[model samples]
Target: MKKITLVFLLIILATTSAQALSWAYPFVVWSGNVYEVTTEEVKNSVISKRIGEVKTKPNDTTGNYYGNASNEYPKGTQYFAISDISTDTAIAVRVKKEKYVKAVFVHKASSHWNPYYYFILFVVAVVLFSLLGKKRFH
Candidate 1:
């Protein structure tokens, strides 16, 4: 029984560590839109330009348009629009990067899954196993 528990813990640790190491491409939020670097070149260029930005806001169900019916740019706002030359996708916008908006601006989808949740679960499992092991030994 002890060996089985030890093996299970090792397996969980290994799998969790592997999952933690896996990297996902980050989504950039700008001008009420979510953009992802579609190519390695664009990723490198954006990093070099220091233009990567992200913002978190309440989920808006309306749409992806920059603004409402008025469609007026905010006062004293300087917009730097970055677009993918090939696909014509808007990548990022400099200035007016509000931190209260979700990254993706699709119709019904929310933000991506957060990896921290998995980490937290792993920690909880480790603690539970340690407690069980101690109780069993005693």
Candidate 2:
């Protein structure tokens, strides 16, 4: 029983570590205080349109839009925007919250993309690469 417990504990630790290491790039769009989603997936995200009226809090997940939806989005998110093909007007925004996931994944402009996490990886790679280069000359 002790052995089994130890193995289970190790597995749990590994799983949690993996999840934390794999941070996602979350992206979001909003129009009139509501997330601009669409009935279909919008491959081309919109850019530079009247942002409407943004009153989002610093890290709050909740937002509202002036537009209204019946049964489609009783919660008030516009799904049609996410399905946009020409997605030129799709505004790109990022909020650190799990509730705001449309397709479960999107390349967001978040702090993860910043030069932070992979900085160590980059240095290690460069050192290994340089050592390999020396082998060729030898």
Candidate 3:
């Protein structure tokens, strides 16, 4: 029983650590301004300009701050200036990091894991509980 409990606790810790995020919230600080992606609108046609790349990682990626780095816009993240074709002025900025992309005009990116991750965790927990129980009984 003790072994099973220990194993279960270990599994929980591993899962939690694996899914830990650098930050939470819909806004990120760039330069000295706070940029937030509130609403998303899909445009049939639009223009984009590559502005720059994220150079530094933030000290604290959790809270809101000014003149600080953003977790979503981590180092190596690519910044793109997005503009609507109907308008000449650039309206939104898109930041792409790894497989995720976040921007004001584009679709919002979810911070939570997909349902599959939860399902996998459930399965692993069930399997561990059964196996550990069997071992204890045997």
Best by TM-score: 3
Per-residue C-alpha lDDT of model 3 across residues 5-118, encoded as one tens digit per residue = 999999988884323345445544443444454445434244365555555444353332323344555555555555543212223435322222334322232343434678
Q: List the residue pairs that clash in candidate 1.
A: 56-100, 56-101, 57-100, 57-101, 57-102
For candidate 1, which ten residues in a row score worst on lDDT? 63-72
Error of 2 at 92 (Å): 14
Provide the lDDT at 60 for model 3. Answer: 53
Model 2: CA > 4 A from native: 17-32, 39-138
Put down candidate 1 lDDT per residue, 13-61, tens digits, no spaces. Answer: 8884322222244344443344443333223233112333332322234
Give the TM-scores of the predictions, in the order they appear. 0.28, 0.20, 0.35
Error of 3 at 101 (Å): 5.1
**lDDT scores of the candidates, listed in order:** 0.38, 0.35, 0.48
- Identify the leading candidate in terms of lDDT: 3
After superposing candidate 3 on the true structure, give the runs of residues whose Cα lies further than 4 Å from its correct spot: 1-24, 38-45, 61-68, 85-138
**Model 3, global lDDT:** 0.48
After superposition on all C-alphas, the RMSD of every candidate to the true structure, in Å, is 16.3, 14.2, 16.4
Candidate 2 minimal-lDDT segment of 10 residues: 62-71
